[model samples]
Target: MDHQGVPSDALDPASPDPAQWPVGRLLSSAARRVERDWNAHLATWDLNHASHAVLAHLLRSPMSQRELATASSVTEQTMSRVLTRMERSGYVTRAPHDDDRRRHVITITDAGRSAFFVASDRELAASMVTRGLTPEQAEQLRRLLVVVAGERGPEDDPDLSAGSAG
Candidate 1:
């Protein structure tokens, strides 16, 4: 089948012909598109999608660097660098942990929150790329993506239940 054409169920994992799998390719292409749109949307703010993600995670509540790393799915070193840049930009503040002075709790500043709101709006607008799909089709796509990622949506993130900034 052509890349623009709908794939058949025979190409699914249930089929024996693993070589014909198109799911991976489709997802990769979609991810690239998302990244491209994200970068373009964030360019106005002089920030990248990764920085926006980190800020979004912090908007929920202050977290240790380690927690931010896990929540952002970024390495600790990467998180540190992002935090340093954010701090220098006056977007975030680091307060010494009450229990452990050696560890600092990172919190989003007013500027950070404002920037986050802008970034969130940009992201929502970019998601309109799927507006052409019907509601049911959107749900089906989401379900299929969830299945492929082997995740249970927000249910998989315990922090989601805590009602943090996000």
Candidate 2:
């Protein structure tokens, strides 16, 4: 049976041979729901999920444009376009790095921080649309997600380990 309590032939346990795994299918369906809700919520700000994610990363630390691109897993050109749009919208500012004149450092502006906080709250609320889970359950889910993403703890990233925000 599918998550909605429907007996989906495509998801029938007996029919599934080598093509699909139940866990993978469940994760995919959940991801689709998250994507749909996230995009809808972001529509109010005229931002996409990627842009919001980039801003969230910047909220944690001011980073060089290249570092931001790497952290966000976006190409340099794409990150540049996103940054340009954000700058025009007054959500972020780019200044020359103090140590390296050639590199541009990206920082979230006050407006950006406010927007990110609002978006994060909206996303958290939307996350409850599927099913309400307790805080413990949410933490467990995060751990599972980290494992799925192949990410190590903060210790793995020296940048994250450092107390400095920039």
Candidate 3:
């Protein structure tokens, strides 16, 4: 293994030869690839993964930049940059909070929701990670990933407890 703990033979990040890597490395590599592919898929819509998340969250509810960063799992600095671009693109609008002049609330525009759905449709069709998995296998994979990420399952959420499809 190299100093970075990557197998010397697997130095090529573009290669799909993770057969010999350790479990952690394999998982990380797979995640990186998935993120890259997802970003590429969103490129046509002039959106990146971070921006997409921000837009989606704003679509759900208006939020401050700090709230968006936390919800999007990004740093406030990163969210600020993303918001700037989004505002410039007219995908969102930032307005001073009525009660809090120091805080700015973000709202998704109609165009943002339209773009989000369009990109979402294409994303579902182009996602390569689940290409050949059966429904059961996909669910298993999702559960395992959720565990690895240390996140609660939908079953744990009160809103999802009413016999909603998993």
Q: Which candidate achieves the best lDDT against the true structure?
A: 3
- Which ranges in model 3 have alpha carbons more than 4 Å from their true place? 1-16, 122-126, 132-136, 151-166
Q: Could you give me the TM-score of model 3 versus the true structure?
A: 0.75
Displacement of residue 70 (Cα, Å) in model 1 is 1.2
- Candidate 2 per-residue lDDT, tens place, 1-166, comes to 7864656665644444534446676687678887887778876776778889888898888988888889989899999999998898888899999988999999999988888787778546536543578766776676567656876755564544463343
What residue runs in model 1 are displaced by over 4 Å at the alpha carbon?
Answer: 1-21, 126-135, 150-166
Q: What is the C-alpha RMSD of each candidate to the true structure, in Å?
A: 9.3, 9.9, 7.7
Better of 1 and 2 by TM-score: 1
lDDT by residue (60-136, candidate 3, tens digit) is 79999999999988899989999999888889999999999999999999988998998887537434677678877
- In model 1, the clashing pairs are 60-165, 60-166
lDDT of each structure? 0.76, 0.77, 0.81
Worst ten in a row by lDDT for model 1: 157-166
Off by more than 4 A, model 2: 1-22, 126-129, 132-143, 151-166
Backbone clashes (count) for model 1? 2
